[model samples]
Target: MVNCKNCGTNITSKFCPDCGQPAALKRIDAHYITHEIEHVLHFERGIFYTIKELITAPGQNVKNYISDNRSRLVKPIIFIIVTSLLYSLVAHFFHTEEKYIKSVDARTIENQFVITSKIFQWLQNHYGYANIIMGLFIAFWAKLFFRKYNYNFFEILILLCFIMGMSMLMYGFFAIIEGMTHTNLLMYATALNFLY
Candidate 1:
């Protein structure tokens, strides 16, 4: 047993002199390493369920999350972190190279890409003003249709994230499906929506 010099507490382990400061472990044991890996795996499983619930029922999931039993759900920031990383990864891989787009259909896709990219660029450049714009849009829509709920624009922003997160997840799923089916379902639908 070693007495912690700072706190004057006696501990058998090397960790605390007396105050329980972690003492370096002597054994770099395989069992300890395996236990740590299993713990991480188990923690990640809970995160997966949280994401699943959030995407499946955005409004309800968020409402419940912010409710009394809050810790049961993953934090909103964590959700955003995970979704943002996945979205960036998917965009990097799935998006076609700009130079390769030459066909009529490719041109159409390129145009849609240009429009969406410009809007995102504008939003990035003016986030504060853009938030106000988006906030007002949300507030107006909410007031028009959801008067009973009594949510404000800021609340709408949270809801929008939930929706967008779900959309990104769905987009990833559908992209995979499109790849497997060898059909341009996502592209055709996107074109129709823009054309209409």
Candidate 2:
């Protein structure tokens, strides 16, 4: 038996029972690189699986994630950030501008609060971070309304992350359609997102 390098625990199997480190770390070769890539993009329990579960049975999947088994679903925060980044990339590729924002005098807004304007601009550019901030507000209200339930604030936030991540994918799909058709479908997409 060899001692686990991670936690110095003696192991008799392929994985350490204490820290779950592999008995023998694989050398950094072509096979190792390919395996690492597959591990990250694994369809079984990775992002694709999470998306499929969320689309099929979101409520039950999230409940299981919070209560029964955590490994089946992707971590909530990573799921949201990945999906949000995907949406942002698709939107950028489609050259989709925020048509909802009307032209305002930049000088007037910048003069009032330069920091506030800068913050807004940053949020506009970074969809992942902006979505997390929005999820916090959503989670707050959800927790307040569902105070009778056993789920805590963080659990509710996790739910929101899964939900918002799916919504971002929906937005990305719509953006592709809009780009192909050369038609403004933002309103429809927003309405569908609200319905979701």
Candidate 3:
């Protein structure tokens, strides 16, 4: 048996049980750089499959995720982040953000808003602390109500995050549709989010 390069652990199987590294290591070369770049771009199986699985059959994905079939699906937090980034990018580059900012009446606010960071302004001058606190409440209630399921607050929080992420993706898709049609479909999007 060879020692694991990662942690010097003894290996009996193809992978080290302790560090989970493979028994063999490839030599560094131009191929290594090419492989690294490919990994970064996920030329192999990656985010596209995750997004497709989530979008097409969220119920099965969530069920599988909760049941520990996570290899195929992206992490809930990662899904949230990617969708949020996509929405932000679309808003930024497509002048949607400018439209929203211009629409907001600065005169209506009586010196309450402080210009601190670009992100703050981009989020419509809202820190969204209320939403976080409310999410905690929802998690707590979910844990209490679903006692038979035996999910802890953290687990419920993850589940809620997954649901929210899915909704965010839907909103992003709706925004794109609205943008293409040059119509105010986001009014419907807002209602959909509220209902979701």
Best by TM-score: 2
How accurate locally is residue 35 in candidate 2, as Cα lDDT from 0 to 100? Answer: 85
Q: lDDT value for candidate 1?
A: 0.54
What's the TM-score of each model vs. the native? 0.49, 0.85, 0.66
Q: What is the C-alpha lDDT profile of model 3 across 1-196, one tens digit per residue?
A: 7888899998888999997998998799999999765543362335566667666786777777887676666666665566566666666555464443443344467544444333446554321332344568999988888899867787777677666666656666776776777776667877877765
Instruction: Output the number of the lDDT-best candidate.
Output: 2
Q: Output the better candidate (2/3) by TM-score.
A: 2
Error of 2 at 79 (Å): 0.9
* Model 3: worst 10 consecutive residues (lDDT sum): 124-133
Worst 10 residues of 2 by lDDT: 97-106
TM-score, candidate number 3 = 0.66
Question: In model 3, how large is the Cα lDDT of residue 28?
Answer: 93
> Order of candidates by lDDT, top first?
2, 3, 1
Tens-digit per-residue lDDT, 35-104, candidate 1: 7655432454345666667656756777765444566565544444455456445533655212112223
What's the lDDT for candidate 3? Answer: 0.65
> Where does candidate 1 stray beyond 4 Å?
1-46, 55-59, 96-117, 120-148, 187-196
